[model samples]
Target chain A: MLKIKVKLVDGKISKKEMVLNKKEVTVQDILDILEINRETVLIRKKNELITEEEILDNGDEIEILRVISGG
Target chain B: MDKSPKCSRCGKKAIIDIRYREEKLCRRCFLKFFEKRVHRNIEKNKMIKPGDRVAVALSGGKDSTLTLYILKEMLNKVKCELFAVTVDEGIKGYRDKAIEFAKRNTKELDLTHIIVSFKEIFGYTLNEIVEKNKVLRGARGPCTFCGVFRRRALNILSRELKASKVATGHNLDDESQTYLMNFFRGDIESSLKMNCDESISELFVKRIKPLSTTPEREIAAYALVKGIPFHMDECPYAQEGMRNVVRVHMNKIESTFAGSRENFYYFMNEIIKHLKTKEKMKFKLSSCILCGEPSSKEICKVCELLKIIRG
Candidate 1:
């Protein structure tokens, strides 16, 4: 199981600890599990912004930031 | 497992990781950085003056909310007046909520909020226009109508308000996407000439995008951290057109190559600068036949679109 902490930056939800029964997980997997739009959020692992296909290791701390489009 | 890093500046627990710069910043440091960058952008471009009355195009989205917030703070230091103008395109479910957020922000900031609607300005809402222009369908999408009318409304309102400058929340991602879209369409001249030759007509309000250097994600993070009230909802009509295609491609390119968006933005700026220096394409401005607004052609784009919608 991979243990990860996910923080929602939009303030809609509190930070939560999530565990997945996988050796490694992609950002899209987490977003899918959370039912969040892939285009709307940026996923960051540790101190680096990761793409949807970037794999996350065990005990990773991730931040999800909503993408803001201009008027 | 890698440990979460502290802010590079303050050593606080970092909330954002700026991949392009390889920097981790806490909420406070990030806000400072964001505001400072916006201030620099304004100063570098000479976008605002000490006594300039700037009109902010507030859509109550994360971008415009942060734009108004940052500009308000910066203008406070310079003793400038700011007015918030919102152009309601009359998108049913989307615009009403955004206008509420815009109203709330304007009230909190104590700035004058002017709300203009498509119905008020063009005699038809976007929905009506879209419904009427069924034959013109794919040739020009609803976004074209909305963008042209909304811009005309903002310009008209800005002049009516006697504002010196119009500030928008166009960030790096938006700039890059626009640049790429124009480039793909072989319409780079129009894109470059937009800001380069705005002084050709006094009727056109000088637009200042202070957040052009900042990325969209950073603006979102800043908005959240600063507690700026904004809705995440997008325009219901936004899913169509070349912009959406370009946006997806731009995002994909940005994700694959870090700093690509900023690089593209700077590259576009450099090209614009070069074009301005090389050939100052003087466009003869004439009054639109239908409306008295200044236009390069016989009729302004808004009026041209209105003709189709009114048919």
Candidate 2:
């Protein structure tokens, strides 16, 4: 089983150990696990933005973010 | 090996089960699950008109370039006339390359182009102004000068070209960023103005954004696929800036929220529809003190910029 650790912009960690061995997972799947909307969040795996369709691999550290909006 | 086109919405592998036409938005984006449902929403709102003379404000970026391409296609069906205008801010390194791209694309599109130079019109390029101002009042932000100057310059050129409507390259991401910025700044009036459709104002030409519903990535992809000339280089002055921070933050929100950008427009539209602004139009005009054109102040922003150059 592939275990993935997740990090939030506020430095919060996901409580669950994500097992990604069963099937292909995506950035959206991780967001689903984290219980956040796509619009309110951005994901970076290894400091690069991962679009929703980007398949996830084992041992990837995902950073989720809430973007700031305004002038 | 799979033999399907990438999803247009998400750029993922196309699953045959989804019945998508082209590109991979998955089942999610294909169903219009986006937060900023700009594509359909604009059609429902009836913002675009047939036979309109549209002068696009080109910045040689992905958004504006793709906007011109799409508008060119859309207008063909509607018999609309199209033109291009680029405001040269004279930013060394940043704008020089973009202007070249803008001019190239204008020729490719076979459209009449107008290039307004800050150096010629304002007598001081951005570099000169920033340098001069820094010696006196210290270093003001690049955006502080660029935004005011470019907007005024575009408006004047749009009028000079006798265009009824000035089209902008503002897309969903830009609009969403602006909406949130206005919300944070407590600027309800400006927010309301953004959501409002093109209306004739004495002070300025009517402004519109035909690509308001399109996503930033889609525009970039369109530009790339169509091979439309564009400047991808990051502006030298744009590093670690406040708007850059806002852009990064907006992208983050956009990734998490399926329709955050769409939601922004809806939110603004709702406010405009129901709770209209009680605040007076901040720049209501008497007349342009110099050119006798309509202006919010005695002298318009365009005239003020010209005075700085003429002095």
Per-candidate TM-score, chain A = 0.83, 0.73
DockQ-based class of model 2: incorrect
Candidates' C-alpha lDDT: 0.78, 0.65
TM-scores computed on chain B for all candidates:
0.94, 0.79
Number of the top lDDT candidate: 1
Clashes of each: 0, 26
Per-residue lDDT of B1-311 in model 1, one digit per residue for the tens? 43445788987766666767878787778878887888888888888778989999999888888888888777657888888999998888889989999999999989899999989988888888888787556368888888888889999999999999889988887788888888888886567655653575778888888888988877776766666778886677777767887777666676567778788888788878777665554454678878889787888887787777766
Alpha-carbon shift of residue B112 in model 2 (angstroms): 1.4
For model 2, residues B1-311, the per-residue Cα lDDT tens digits are 53334666676643211211224554345434332354454457665677678899998876778667766766655677899999988888878889888888888878888889877766778888777755555444666667777887888789888887788888777787787777778877666667555353665778777677766655543444345668765565664346667777765665545556567776776766665544444334467768776655678656765454344
In model 1, what lDDT does residue B269 have?
84
Candidate 1 C-alpha error for residue B285, in Å: 2.9
Please report, as a residue range, the 10-residue window in candidate 1 chain B with the lowest summed lDDT.
B276-285
> What is the C-alpha lDDT profile of model 2 across A1-71, one tens digit per residue?
67777776532344455776555677777777676655444455565444555666677677765432221
